[model samples]
Target: MSADVAIIGAGYTGLSTARYLAASGVEPVVIEASRIGWGASGRNGGVVSGKFRIGFAEMARRWDLETARRMHDLGIEAIDHVGETIEELGIKGADYRPTGSLRCAHNQVALDALRAEADWLTGTLGDQAISMLGPEEMKAETGSRDFPGGMLNRHGGVIHPLNYVLGMARALAGQGIRIYCETPVTRLGRTADGIELHTDRGVVRARQVVIATNGYSDLTPATDAVRRRLIPFRSAMIATELLDRPMLEHDRSYTETRRMMRWFRKAGGRLVYGGRGAFGKADSAAAFAALEKAMRRQFPQLAGVAVTHRWSGLVGMTMDSLPHLSRLDDRVTFSLGYNGTGVALASMIGRHAARMVLGQKTDAGLLTSEALRPVPFYEIREPAVRLVAGYYQFLDAIGR
Candidate 1:
């Protein structure tokens, strides 16, 4: 069908952009290679927050101070956006709870870093919602005596990510947005009128095109800028069998450590943990075993917990850990590279991309800045990433 805008990839970014575009009287068509949210957007720990390792200060330096704050706030606001949409549309299955998020440090040094980060968010960044937790408090809240200290952000929350995406797609489809599943666009040809997207079923033409395929981005023709700037990394996650009643009562999402950070939470009454998988073997048996062993070591009470589900997905990792929203060409725009933090950022970036495409001005920041240039030597990024992943896997094996 003909449209004003055609979006490839019906994951969070594509869905959000389609909704906004449709609301603005633009009946955008979203084409998904598989089912909606079939990628990382569907499979995630569902932590919706802006507490990224890429702190606000660095963001301000890269983009602008005001823009950085606004971008950070946007990430925080995406959680509310999801909740509001669920309520407005009366979606039943997408469970959203504002339970907040905690970041614990396994060691004393890392605990100090957590305290410092919390302090920076409060003192410098003016985000007072962050509170430092002592060792005793961490033990009480997380039911993990191994944690030395931590920080909690009340603005953060969790949800069933897949259910949310599916609900979003349904909401958009009801609003005249044409969503075609299992229709991957193999060719994107620019014409005088607009862009042509060639899919397996047929071809579509549109004035504007958006590439929302974050990690799985190679399917369509990408501008050199995008190809050079973004690197895809695979993250693995495993969910344990429904924990016994005692463990269930103390379940909450959390993360720890310096390099290989662990992000996990209780979903469907089972403990789900995520982290860097074994590079090329991301989510392979070795990776799953490592995740389970690490989890068991963290909470020996859960040593009896057997893994029931294991999966992995590629994430677009930008050097700055921020995503890009810009015009690669005259009509082609994109918002990619969530840096393993897509739950909230994808929705927020999708909104930014929509605004940019719709010709609305946005606060320029690291998350939405022209200064987000391509990384140096980016052509070799994929190979370098693979090498790094292999090295990390080897080190992880030796307990380094």
Candidate 2:
């Protein structure tokens, strides 16, 4: 099969890329090893916050204030874009809510930091959409007394992830975009005309190829260099049975301020909670048990609740803790390393990547202007991540 462009991986990035490409009058073929949204895109906590893995203050310290502000604005725009797309496409079953989100602090020190961040966002950066929620407000909103305070971004909310991506897939299919599930690209090579992707079912030759595999990327000689820059880590989530009363007073998504954070939200009358998993293990019964224990610790009211579903998915983490979008070559472009936050950012970056592939200027600002550097000792990332997770757990225990 041949096309103008081919996309690998049917997650948010690939599917959104195909959607945007098709809307631009370019029909692209999307190839996926599994069904759409089979990876982190489907198994996540479903919170759509207007923030990246890196905070605004840290980004400013690392880069510059203006650049940091631009990045932060881009995040908010991404969240708005998701809502607009859902409405514009008339995607059914998305369950998208613009009700906002909460970032709760586990302790007083974290609460202070959260307040300072909120001040910087609203006062210094002129982002009036984010506000500070005190302990009483936090308790009222989340029905959890464990948090001292929190930060609320009115632009963010939650969605039904699987439904959203599936809707995108159906929309693209109706637009005449070819979607091949259960098809894995074994080899990627450059041709005189463009690029060639060797898949199990057949070969796809296209003038442009998009590598959107993210954490589930297959490392071959052609992509090994790019893969070395990403560290794939597993995140596990569990959903509890329907509750008689709503857990939170208000319907909103919530996450902690810990180094290894825990995120939760109410969906379909059930509470879905998720966090970082055992570094080396993909999914385990013990991990789910641990997650349940953590969830109960935060909301003791649900101590005896039955878990209805437990699943884990791999997320690509960059060393610098930022997402990267760049063209690997003249014919190959890629976007990955969302650093455990992909739902909003990935959809925005995917469209940006599509624009890049079409030889159009994208307002990626400072993010896509540079190449991703390789992570040191990339082969030993598993062990290193395990050690880091252990250290973060210790810090969280001490309220640091």
Error of 1 at 19 (Å): 0.5
Cα lDDT tens digits, model 2, 244-329, are 77677577888888988888889899988998876664578888889999998888889678889998989998887778888887
What value does the lDDT take at residue 133 in candidate 1? 86
| Winning model by TM-score | 2
Question: Lowest summed-lDDT stretch of 10 residues in model 1?
Answer: 244-253
Model 2 off-target regions past 4 Å?
219-222
Question: What are the models' TM-scores?
Answer: 0.92, 0.96
The reply for model 1, stretches above 4 Å from the true place, is: 60-64, 220-225, 248-251, 375-379, 386-400
TM-score result, candidate 2 = 0.96
lDDT of 2: 0.85
